[model samples]
Target: MARIQTMRVDRMLSSMGYGSRSEVTRMGKAGIITLDAAEIADAARRIAVTPDLPARMKIDGEALDPLTGVVILLNKPLGMTCSHKDSGVLIYTVLPDRWRRRTPVIATVGRLDKQTSGLILLTDDGDLLHRIISPRSRVRKTYRATLARPLAGNETELFASGELMLDGDAKPLAPAELSVVSETEAIISVTEGRYHQVRRMFAAAGNHVTELHRERLGGLSIPDGMASGQWALLEADNIASIFHMDPAKQT
Candidate 1:
């Protein structure tokens, strides 16, 4: 069985964006919050936030489900900026108003440039985001890139050897995998997320990236049926897959 995780009432409520810690404390004192049908006056009281526990919690007559953290996978479309501030079309605008208003603020795990498109993960769980994007985790990100010129000889070996250097970098990138799909298009997989890494890597190899589309991240692939600008909730199993582990076996 999965172990139960606990958090203080005020911290949980505030993290979910209900209000500030002091405000939640005040609400608790006013008898607006309850745990398992019993009135809870102490904001610091710890309660289970795990699925393994049966904890019925409510605030002001509304039920709360703390165990199920929000995670979403988006089929990001081109011409959208992955930002809250509008430089071009804001990617967050594509999501429903409720998701945007979520407490703790659901954020994109990693950014895709304005012209890039494909799978993007958004989540309210900070730990999951860090695990997926951290270089130390070595999570694989796969991209299908269209090049301005045909891939030249020895480039694939160079990429696989992790010896290609970008401008202003003293060291070569970690080893990557490359496969040719056509003369001008190929699939590339890397474990790092440097700025314009794909484009710069190609440029350093004497080629230029004309178009780039991310196809996969970690063990999650963009669903073929998902249309551009669409999104779907990532269930617990999907979350587990991000770490390349089985949900039942996850600690």
Candidate 2:
């Protein structure tokens, strides 16, 4: 188990989603919180958290375990908005209540529109989340799109040249890779996340995207057997793979 340095009792509890600082203070004063079976009266008392160690806390008479970071890969289904306050069904609805209730609330690394579906990443680690989503990271995302019309002449070269003009912008998008899968289907790879980029790119090319699905991100592909709306925890190797980093090289 990794050992995190000591932190204030209230901060620790609040970080683990136990409650707000004021609420934790109330619990501490009520003697409902214990450290190593001893009543903790000071909310500012510092304590270490080691996951491998035996239970060190009891809240409201129930033994509590130390919290750990988590990463999840969800196979997003159509019609669910990634936003927390969307008018449609929320992506969080697909995850278990336990994860939603945990501290450092799990958040999607990037967004996919409600009409699009496929691999999406979630994590409680803020650093990892920022690394994956940050444009400077230059992580590549691959998508398979179904178009309303057959790919036209020289469009492949146009996309590869990265000079397609998008609305509301004076500059063209960065170069992207495009491959024709069929008359009306194609695969696109890009490192940037522009709003409706794929759809807009096709529109600029005189084509319409009827469907879009993300197939891969960075070095990780959607694992087989993961059905739509299903989710699974990403292990250490999987996390490392997402960033294409060696475990030993991770900060």
Candidate 3:
């Protein structure tokens, strides 16, 4: 089990996006915060942060939000841009206002274009974020693409040949798997995240991707019944699933 850490009530609240020290103190004075069934008397009081602490504490009569180091899985919706600075609807707006002010700041593991949607991860754990996106990880990303035209009949062999190079790319792509779902649709999995990679790959193979949605990253897939614009915090098991290898898809 992970070690249970401790921190001052004010620091914890501030870092977790509850509020600043003064605001938290004000909230405590107003009887809006409690720990172990008692009102907090001091913001500076240090308390053990246990896994069950959120349940043991209440803020405004509701359970405290999850502690920091959170990993979130969001089912992204179409027309929502992932970039924070770019114009148009942004996915971050889907989260709480406090989430936008978190100390470490939750960030996307990798980007999905506005036109594409499906399982996407955001995390405050920087190391975990880097490990998942790092080249050495070779974490597989699977996408379901709708093509503008039918397959050319040789894309499977071409993509699997490990010699396919995208336009303006300097290196050959790593081996990829293609499972055709229909004449104009297929499931493609790749170990790399290059610029417009999935679409570019199809284009390079003489096809155009009309639509795209990421279905899986490694062993983790979008939760069933999860609708677009919906998201939830990922538990340890869910996070671990990201690195699990499937015997069937070794890449």
Winner by lDDT: 3
Residue pairs with backbone atoms closer than 3 Å in model 3 (clashes) = none
Candidate 3, 220: how far from true, in Å? 1.0
Sort the predicted structures by lDDT, highest score first: 3, 1, 2
Off by over 4 Å in 1: 1-68, 245-251
Q: Can you write out model 3's per-residue Cα lDDT over 1-251, one digit (the tens) per residue?
A: 87768898888889878888899888878887898889987878889998889999998898998777889999999999887778999889999988887888889999999999998999989999999999999999999999999998899999999999887999999999999999999999999999999999999999999999999989999888999899989999989989877436665
The stretch of ten residues in a row with the least summed lDDT in candidate 3 is: 242-251
Q: What is the lDDT of residue 65 in candidate 3?
A: 83
- On the 0 to 100 scale, the lDDT of residue 37 in model 2 is 79
RMSD in Å for all candidates: 5.5, 5.1, 1.9
Instruction: Please give the lDDT score for candidate 3.
Output: 0.90
- Candidate 1 Cα lDDT to native: 0.83
lDDT to native, each model: 0.83, 0.82, 0.90
Q: How many clashing pairs per prediction, in order?
A: 0, 0, 0
lDDT digits (tens) for residues 156-188 of candidate 1: 899988778889888899998888999999989
Sort the candidates on TM-score, descending order: 3, 2, 1
Candidate 3 lDDT score at position 135: 91
Identify the runs in model 3 with alpha carbons over 4 angstroms from their true place.
1-4, 247-251
